[model samples]
Target: MSYRRKHTAQTFITNALALLFIFLFIYAGLSKLIGMSVFKDQLSQVPLTTQAAPFLAWAIPTVEVLVVVLLLWPSLRRWGFFSFLGLMLVFTGYLIYTLYFSPYTPCSCGGVISGLSWRSHILFNLFFIGLAVLAILLVPSKSLEKQQ
Candidate 1:
């Protein structure tokens, strides 16, 4: 109810969300990097992705780490949000594609995160996409007058 309380509440929410994003990205990236055998196994589970599995295992983690770094910086954070949004959308699309096109379900996503069914996968992507959108929307825009 108090002005100070409201500001504190808003700051808490923003920082919490940022921390969540940072943790998830870094953890997942490390999982992929350190668990290559598991990552490969998960990728091989998808019929069409078998050939692409190796490349993705290496690439995804690198991109994720970069995104995490970008998101941590105040100035470059929008690019991070945008990149994450795109990545999540692509992942959601992959899940949909695999659900309908692939003969077998890919059990290789990488441990707990990878084992999710198509529906859960879509929901997962949507959750992050929502977060990225919220982050972008909440980011403050500075004016030239403020700079001077």
Candidate 2:
């Protein structure tokens, strides 16, 4: 309950969440790059995405990596936080679209979450989305933290 201890805890949580997002984004982006053929094939199977497969194939991983870079710098870390938050929301939306509207939901080509069932995958996305939201809420703005 000491002020110092509380401050340490807050700092730890902030850094931990930043690291978490960094790891996830890097892993995902690498997975796509490493398994390009498989990822492209998976994207092709999704309804209404066949034509955009080429564009998305390059774009998703690129943005993920960009977010990782953003997270590494203190000055731009807030942008990283917001980027991941938006990405997670978009991901969840795609997952829902596949589950409810598409005829079939294809599995991810790589990453730990690839093994999860569709329902579990949804939960997984939601879990990370919640984490992102929590991190954003808990971490002080860079200027504010510096001034503290």
Candidate 3:
């Protein structure tokens, strides 16, 4: 394909990925907000995160919403992709920790994700992480474009 066609395709792919993240965050964040009690309670059961659970309980959804807002603007899409990737990485790390180290870890994640087995959840996170990475790669950098 020509550079223009390829660029357009990549842009479409990246935008689609961002839209997916937007939907995921809105759905998950709203679910967490709706079930605040259950989410906070489950977080309290975790061993290492017990103390921080209260803060994280609110912070997670807040950040998710913030990132979604950033993703909506073309100018801020790069930041959104980075922020989304970081969140997914942290989530994946926790899942890995829970899967191997924590003997009786409870799922505090809101919505349908709470139903996923630890192993399946890890896979799920990996998939989203992949999408974030793809979005990051496909987003054209203005400076680099000019140099080329």
Best by TM-score: 3
Off by over 4 Å in 3: 145-148
Give the Å error, residue 76, model 2: 1.7
Lowest summed lDDT window (length 10), candidate 3 = 41-50
lDDT (tens digit, per residue) of candidate 3 on 33-86: 998888887777767677988898899899999999999998899899999999
Q: Tell me the deviation in Å of residue 63 in model 2.
A: 0.5
Estimate, for each residue in 20-51, the C-alpha lDDT of model 1 and write its tens digit.
88888788888777888888777777876788
Q: Cα lDDT of model 3 overall?
A: 0.88
Compared with the true structure, the alpha-carbon lDDT of candidate 2 equals: 0.85
Task: Point out where model 2 deviates above 4 Å.
Answer: 1-4
Indicate whether candidate 2 or candidate 3 has the larger lDDT: 3
Number of the top-ranking candidate, with lDDT as the measure: 3
lDDT of 1 at 97: 81
TM-score of 2: 0.90
lDDT of 2 by residue, 22-84 (tens): 999999999999988888888888986778888888899999999999888867777888899
- The TM-score values for the models, in the order shown, are 0.79, 0.90, 0.93
